[model samples]
Every structure is written in structure tokens, then in C-alpha cells.
Target chain A: MTEAIQKTVQPIGVATAALETKRLSAWFGDLHVVKDISLTVEKNDVFSLIGPSGCGKSTFIRCLNRLHEETDGARVRGEVLIPGAGKRENIYAQGVDPVSIRRRVGMVFQKPNPFPGLSIFDNVAAGLKLAGVVRRNVLEEIVEISLVQAALWDEVKDKLKKPGTSLSGGQQQRLCIARALAVRPQVLLMDEPTSALDPISTARIEELVMKLRSDVTVLIVTHNMQQAARISNQTAFFLMGELVEVGPTKSIFTKPKDSRTEQYITGRFG
Target chain B: MIELSSRDGVRKFSNYFWLAMLCLLAFTAIAPLFFIFAYLLVRGWAGLSFAFFTEIPKPVGEVGGGMANAITGSLVLMGLSTVFGVPLGLACGMALSELKKSAIAKMLRISIDLLTSVPSIVIGLFAYALVVVPMRGYSAWAGGFALSIVMVPIVARSTEEILKLVPASIHEAGLALGLPRWKVLIRLILPGVRAGVTTGILLALARVSGETAPLLFTAFSNSFGYRGLSAPTASLPVQIYTYATSHDETWRQLAWTGALVLVFVVFCLNLVTRILTRRTV
Candidate 1:
């Protein structure tokens, strides 16, 4: 058990990299959605990915957790490295389990998808329970902590027994966040998680994303440039399945190195 | 405005004419069902009595008897058929839904479709040849095996369609949580569609219980008591057929009440299935 835990843990002295990609590319059948792109997210950085519709930012993050290949006729070719056996291991390696990688790298989708059949408490504990953590007391404690981390604890703590879907749209999204956090992921991926919510709800999520940085590295894809400017410390610009520019969020907004990045961010053209 | 006004009168007349015609046609479609209900209620009301629920069949030409054995036999056959059919049908459906474009699924789909269209009587013959001849007796085992053949296709098809109705996104959510494929299915997917799958099983049961031709040769008919799964067993449909065709007036009357009871059971099953499906939606 200790060996297993040590294997998943990173070496103490190596420079911390929560997520890194090496020439990662993906395709849905013959249509390439994400081109070869190498990038790194420092541990605890709120990294934002900004792009136009169908620009492949969503597909890129999906590949990070190996979720892209789950689609019918979809395929990925790349290297995604996270902690494995006391070092950063390429997740796409032949023997690596995608499901195991996903547990370590949690995701919150664009639309809030709380398991409708479960209560709020069960929704947060689903990952833990599925991972073989079954004791009620252990589940209760982890659920409360995760909910508090997602900033949804106070609102839902009293009604943890209510169906997860009964919550308001924003609350539902936060519930999903809490669910993702319960498993203690080292990196969290948000695939335009606020696009389906109202401005106020979006504001709450943006705030939560910033606060989440204390524990996990965050990679967020968003159509809203202002959201990236407000919440993210670093930003990567993508266009036509390729990364155009990446830098500090302030610089990416104030002065982009690529002409397309300037045009797209400046509202000249997408 | 000119274009809209030019055809307004003609369009209005066409719309009203088709609407009225369709309403009449729709009523025509449903009229026979109400007529059947009224006819059965009137004809079968006299045959019902306290004895009908509590007593076993009194021998032929006798009065004041019940089809208690047949009722219990029908329940047994339904239970046996459900045991034999539901798990296999559910497994078939899961395979069909998961392997959408596979060659194996295509073949399985075609086979199930063909099985559904096969006459129930032919299924009885199949069970007769497969079980009756081998076992050298008509028994509840043969009857249930035959009825299960009639059930598998319905359950499999409905389960496939119902499982499909659950959006792919919900399934993906489970997978994203790092749950294994089977865990996601049992914990997330199946529970989400529990009512719907139950509706399919109930529908299959309704059809199975009402089956007359399939049980004719497979289960034969008994008047006294259920022997065992390996013994000839009585059933409501077979009993009704025998009573209806008998020379005795009292037997015919008993047949009407037996049919009424069977009809009520099927109607209740259908009603429950409807409610369950509504909950699923």
C-alpha cells in the first residue's frame, strides 16, 4: 500500500509540473481536432485556454486526462505526463490506465452534470465510493471537505440528502466541482464550465477557480476573455486546432506575440 | 402579406378538413377497444363468484368451482419465464447498445427481430421439440421455456431503446469519474433507467401470461393442482380455451370469468408499465 502511494507521488526535489503535454494531437476519425501541441502547467497555476468556437481548446484538455479517445471513432497520439512511480510518467504509455489517470486529474464539464439519481452528498462521494471507499463516516467527512472546497458547503450542507439535480444551475455546477475534488485530484480541468450559467453563477465559479489554486493546478477553457483576464495567471491562445501563443495572462491580453491572437482577442476576427 | 392573404382561405379549409378527418380516424382506431371492454364486462360479470377465487376447478360439467390451480400455475410460469429470460434479455440489450455498429450486434438484432415475428404457436412447437420430446412430457418447464422465447425479443428490444434514451453524456460522466465500465453501468446507467427496464419486463410478463397458443402443447392442461416444474401445469389462458370450447354451459360461463380475470391482470400490468415509463421520462 505504501509502495502504491509512493508510486503516485512526485519526487520531492524535482521542479513541480502538474501537467505537461508533448506533441499531443487528437482526431475524431479523420478530422483532426487538436494538433500537436506541447505545453506545461505549473503546480497551482490557474492556466486559461482562450480560443474561438471549434478551435480545439476543449479537445486539448480532454486529451490531458485521455477522455478524448472515449468518443466513437476518436483517436489521440501524444504524451501526457503526470506523477507516476516517483516521477512524471507519460499517461499515454501502453500500460497506463486511463481511468487511473482521470482519478488523479479531475474534470468539470461545460454543462453542470450532477448524477440526477444521487443526493448531493452521494454526488460528492461518488468518486470515493466507486474507488472502494465505503465506510459512511469516511465518506461523510470527505464529502463535507470537498463541498467546502468547492464553496458549495454552506448552501447545500443542510440539504445534503436532496437530489443533486434539485439545486439551482450554479449550485449544480459547484456540486460537480465538489464531486471532482473529493477524490483529491492533483490537476483539475474545466472545459468552459461557466458557459452554461448566468453571469452571477459564472462569477461564483471564477472565484472558486482562483481559490482552488491553493490545492490543485487548474486548466480552464473559456470563450470569455475577461473571465481569463480576471481569474487566470497564465493564458494559452488556440486557433484552428493549433496553439498560437501562450504567456502570462496580462501580456496575452495586453500584447500578444501572434497576429491572429491579437486579432481574435481584440475582437477583430475569430 | 399578399402571398399570405392569397392562400389563407384555402389553407384554413384544408387544415380544418384534415383535422376533422384525422380526429374521426383516431376515434375509429380506439372505438373497438372500448367495445371489447364493455362486451367482456357484461358477458363475464355473471361468471365471477367467491368460489372463482378460492376453489380449484370442479371436474367438467360441475358448478361452483374456481380456476385456482390455473391462477397459481400462471404465476409460476411467469416467475420461471422471468428467471430464465430477464437476465439473458438484459445482457443481450446491453450488448446491442454497447456494440452499435459491430457485425455481431447487427446479426443479433436481425435474429431478435426475426424471433419476435415468429408465431407464438411455432415457439410452442419449438419448445415441444426441444424440451417436451426430450423430457418425454409436457411440463411447466417446457411452458416457461416457450414463453421465455416470446419474452426475450420484447425485453431485449425495449431495453435497448430505453438504455439509448439515457443520454450518452450521463454515461460519460461516470467514465470521467474513473469508474470502470461495469461499475458505471450498474451504479449509474441501470439505476437511471430502472423503471424503463422494469416496464419492458412487465410488458413481457403481460404478453406471456395472456399467451394461449404457446402453452397449448408445452404445458398442456391440468385441472387439479400444480405438480412441479417438471409436471404438466395448468394456466389461465389454456384453461379458458378448454372451458370455452367445452359442451357444458357452466364450463363456458367459467371460461368467461377466467378470461375476465386474465384480462384484468394484463390490464393492470399495462397500467403499471405506463406509469413506470412516465417516471422514466
Candidate 2:
């Protein structure tokens, strides 16, 4: 059974570097939230950032989308790049619009805030709507395909008219995923997406994450080491706002090169 | 047994003490309403007639017509006030909620607070000097301008409070979707707080509906039905004031009817707004 599972889970296809950060850091006032963190995400792969609370895994993930800007004397003297037009686009360029950046790199927050005043259909179509695609048929197709991609279409197919917030917590998170997918973004960021869910819901989201690896590059921030091992192809462990180690999930768990990685994996201290 | 009795005695006395205090506070809040309502009902009772509604106030000693002129003028002024005040107030509220850190928002907030605390009588005088005297006469438009001054602050402050109550997570969600800030506010944030805005508008309407001092200087007193916005107009509260002070039995009765109508309209508006807020959430 183990051999068969290994064969089925073997890295199926080629991957490309989708996003990379060099010496990225975040700060609030004078306090460093994420320090000198550097990592890379490849296409069609699930890369998980995991650490204890205040270790800055979430901060690092937020920085990828430029959510946590270094304000009040806080500075990030690094580069974050996304591949564009057969080359890399430096996202930190002075004139680049963060709004446009966010459209290409979508994020799902920790709590399921799925545009409470909107219908389930509209919630999925928010980004497209924002980008000014008002065609009904096009919106309908995108909403359907995105929801299916997020594995939530079967449950919400008949209730597209209902408010998005009416769904259960797990379903709401999936709806948020679908909402992000509606824009057909190249990279999808999830910040503690399953921390607010029950165990069963968390398992379902993990399975969904694994499935989504084929369509969009995924980078998730999580506190659950077991979840990282289950869903991610690669795991990046963080400590004190620093990227301590990053490698294949299996190796990171079974044979970590760094003592801190081993300590964290073995539950010695976060 | 003595200890048990002593414990029971302590509990009973404390309970009674709290109960008495609660009752006193409730009574303190309600006493003025009870007395004023009772007074209005008794004194305004005789003026309750169809003629009372249709006639215009005449000379103090003589029988007059209903407050038809006042009623119509009040409706027209309040309508104009709502139109002028609600949107500006809502826009100010949106600015405060969405652009909280901006310098203009900070300045506008201070000004709104000042506007809210400025007395209604002062607003009336300001309108008279700014609008009525300049226009060379008291008119429904001037009255509306004064009422809107009172309304803008109430609507703005209440709207700001309501918008603030919406969770910041909602804004984050919109920003995450890559929607521009303006689009997020108009599409997502505003709809979420629609009920609150409506409630504020209604409350503002109630406030301006009963104001007598402002209209005294702006709408002044139109004994006969004025035909245009440029001419002086009568309103219910002003009619109530003039008639209630007169010795004529018929004038006083007409004032009672006008009072009843004004109170009923305000009450209905309040009830509907409350229900709307409840249903929305």
C-alpha cells in the first residue's frame, strides 16, 4: 500500500519558478515582524510556511502579496519577483500598482470573510467584477468553474443566490478559495485558511490544496506541522521572523539538516 | 437557623435596593414624556377636527382654519432637508470610515462634532442671517436650509458610528479581491451598513420635524397658504406654538390635531427604521 501510494503521489509534472523573494522582511513601527526571509515558490506546487505564533510565518506570507508593508521606519531591503512575459517582473518597483499586483496574486485570509453583503455567485465573481467584466454569461462560467475547482460547486450549485456568509465555516473558506480562483490568478496565497475550521473541514481543505497544485501555484501559512506534511510538496520552517530551513516536505520532516528544524518537527519548541 | 435567616435578610434587602433604583431610573427617564404627553393630550384634545387640519391660523381672538398650510409647508421643508442632508452626511461618514487616516477626514470629524453640538436656535439665527435676510424674506427653502443644518450633523455622526461598527475584516476581504478602494466601499461596505444609514436618515427626519425655533426665523409664520418656495411658509410646530399660546378655543384645538399628526408621523418613521435595521442584520 505504501509503495502504491508513493507511485501515485510521485511529482507528476515539470514545475517553474512562479514567485521568489530575496531578503524580504516586515516591520511594524520599530519591531521586526518578519526578518530577512527568503523563499521561492514553483508553479503547480504547494509550498507551506509554518511556524509558531509570532514566528512571522503569516507575516512572511502577507509580505508575498505586499499586504504587510514596512511602515514607520520599517524597511524591506530585498526583492520579490513574479515571472512575466518570459522574464521576471520586479514587484517592488516604484511605479507598480499594488492593486494590479494583488489581482495577479490573490490571497485568502485566515477567517472566512466572503463579502457578507454579496450573493454566493457575486462573492466568487468579485475580482472579475472589480476588473470590470460585466458580461453575465462570462461571470456565470467563471463562477461555476472556480467553485468546481475549489471543490465547493457540488454543495453550493443550487444556492448561488444565497448569501456567501450563510455557508458553514469550511464551506465559506472554500468559497473564498473559489472567489480567489475566479480571477484566474497565477498565484494563490492562503493564510491560516483552516485554523478556524474543525478537524474534518481541515482535512477536506488539505485534500483540496493538494488537488489545486495542478492549476495554480499555492503558498500557505500554517501553524499545523502535520497539515504542512500532509498537503505541501515543500515546507519552509520559520523562527524569529527568519526562514530557518526549506526543502522537500518529506526530507524536512524525516531528515532535517538543521537542528532547529528537527527541534520544531519533533515538537521540542516552536 | 439564625444564620440562614440573616443570609436571607441580606439577599432580600439587596434585591429590593437594586429593584428600587432601577425603578427610579426608569421613572426618571419616563416622567417628562408622561407629563408632556398628558398635557398635550388634554389641552390639544379640543382642536382635533378636519377644519383644524385645513384651516390657517387667523387673528388671535377669532376662529381660524386648519393647519393645512403649516402641514404642507412642514412636509415640503422636511423633504428638502432630507434631500440636502442625507447624501452629504453619508459621504462624510464613508470618508471617515474608509479614509480614517487622511487629514481631511480628521478636520471634517471635528467640524461635524461642532455642528452636532451647535444649538438649534443658533442654527435658526444663522440661517436667518445667511439665507432669509439675503433672500429678503422667510421662505420654505430657508426653513429647509436651517433644518438641514440640524440634520447633517445627526446623520453624519450616527452614520460614522454605524460604519465604524462594520468589521475591518470586510474591508480586508475587498482589498484582497483587488477591488479599488472606492469600489469596495460602494459595493461591499455600503450595502452592509444600509440599514444603519436608513435609520440615521429617519432619526434625522424626526429631529428636524419637531424643531420650532429654527423654522420661527426661517419659515416664519404664514397665516395663509403660501404658494411658492420664495414666499414665507408655515409649519406644524410653529403653528402649534402660535395656537397653543392663543386664548381662542378653536385655534388651540387645531394645534392639538397638528401635534397628533406630527407625533404619529415621527413615530411611524422610527418604527419602520427600527424594523428595517432588525431585518437587515
TM-score for chain A of every candidate model?
0.94, 0.91
Q: Which ranges in model 2 have alpha carbons more than 4 Å from their true place?
A: A1-15, A70-76, B1-11, B49-64, B101-104, B223-226
What lDDT, from 0 to 1, does candidate 2 have?
Answer: 0.85
Highest TM-score model number = 1
Look at candidate 1 and tell me the lDDT of residue B11: 96
Report the C-alpha lDDT of model 1 over A133-166, residue by residue, as the tens digit: 9899999999999999999999998899898989
Q: Is the docking of candidate 2 incorrect, acceptable, medium or high quality?
A: medium
Residue A181 displacement in candidate 2 (angstroms) = 1.3
- Which has the greatest DockQ? 1
lDDT digits (tens) for residues A1-270 of candidate 2: 999898457443213678888788788777887888767777877999888889988877777766665223545557788877677787887897778778888899899888867899989988898789999999999999999999999999999999898999999999999998888888999999999999998988888989988889999999888889988999998989888999999999999999999988899996
Report the Cα lDDT for candidate 1.
0.90
What does candidate 1's lDDT look like per residue over B50-161, in tens digits? 8887788887667778888899899989999999999989988988988888899999999999999999999999999999999999999999999999999999999999
lDDT of each: 0.90, 0.85
* Candidate 1 displacement at residue B250 in angstroms: 1.5
